[model samples]
Target: MIEIQGNIKTVGLTCGYRNMPIVSDLDIVLPHGKVSCILGKSGCGKSTLLRTLLLLERPLAGDIRFGNLSLNKLTAEQLKQLRRQTGVLFQGSALFNSMTLLENAAFPLIERAGLPRGLASELALLKLDVVGLSRYAHYLPSAVSGGMRKRCGIARALALDPPYLFLDEPSAGLDPLTSAEIDDLVLEICDALATTVVVVTHELRSIERIADHLVMLADGGVAAAGPPDQVRRSDIPAVNAFFSPQSNAAPLIDPHHGLASLLLDEE
Candidate 1:
């Protein structure tokens, strides 16, 4: 079993921009080797929370830790090292228009890791193959469908073999079938590689298929945080509404099992 300290966690965290808080007093735990998704409507701070964890968005208060490395307390060198262990796929897939899929995937190995070009290309092809993009390795991002581009972005993110991967809106512009494919790939990555993944999205179908744990945000804080079933059963109207958008019914809340305690009292 994974130890509590080995998981990525937040302590009384407050995330925001320009001093305006988006989410406050958060104590979230991303269980080691699991897929934990952040779910909410637009402006609910799902992406802000993720970016805070990545240190791209500065936290207004509180602390974040990945294993024993405290985000707020790290030395510059340590922080840099920590960043290397993380990979990210931005909302738009962020691929360079000029680079072929293979070249884009290999860019990190050649530049960030300083690997030789030939070896990097060989390893990149393997990553592309993982995403079923071997046939499109030579295609530019503009030449492929949005789903394919997203897949390539995912491949590039995996090139560094980071233990943690953060994906933002991975199914944003895709059809239902393509969204399902992305969900399948996420599950495959988590199960086969044992990579801890944090996805920020409101795609219900994708979330249902891939999320092992859920953190639902609303009213500038966590509405519910727990296993998918438990969160789905939350009495919080927004949380229930998300899981059952077609109706106005909401499940009963177990006051004995408040969400804050899930992290506050973790062993």
Candidate 2:
């Protein structure tokens, strides 16, 4: 198993597209060997922050440091070395349609780790099993359901056994049962592999199921950061509204019934 010993610290971090920052002066520390979920309402820069941590985008300012290595200071070769120790599961799953599940999962090991095809295949199969998709190893992406494709994507991410894993909205577009299954899979992976996982999600159910540490963002800042239980009781307007949205909800209406009918009923 890989040994991930230190926290990922972002000091005064600002992220956005081009010059106009969406989130600014953010200071958050992702604890070591834990599942840290970045939570917020939609379009609040959670995904953007994840991208910055993955070095897919440059930070407008500040530094992203993992243990002793500063991301901003790394040379191209150094950055590549750093990235090999990290894994990312994109929102779309991003599986190649041309390849079988096993082949797609093994591609990372073969390309990045320089493992022989046989060994890579073995490792990939093991990861597939971890995500409960080993039975469908030879199936094409098009043949699988969305959840199965997500499992395959996760298997590929784990192919190289990276200690640090980042998953962007893994539960999005999935049914509640399938989404819960994915949540359980993440917890299982973290326990079995001692992996440090950072999940960017707005799903309350997911955060409740898997998050050990929580960071809720609003107005380009950390509105609340703490354990799940504490964040639930947070008094901050943005944080509170996010967690207990139904508290101030409007009267229920049947969308299938026309709005005019609802108004007539009210009248």
Pairs that collide in candidate 1 are none
Report the lDDT tens digits of candidate 1 across residue range 145-264.
Answer: 999999999999999888888999999989999889888998999898788999999999888899999988988998899999899877888987888877874434553577744665
The number of clashing residue pairs in each candidate reads 0, 0
Worst 10 residues of 2 by lDDT: 248-257
Q: Write the per-residue lDDT of candidate 2 for residues 56-77, one digit (tens) a residue.
A: 8999999988877887787777
Clashes of 1: 0
Which one wins on TM-score?
A: 2
**TM-score per candidate, in order?**
0.89, 0.90
Off by over 4 Å in 1: 1-5, 249-267
Model 1 vs. true fold: TM: 0.89
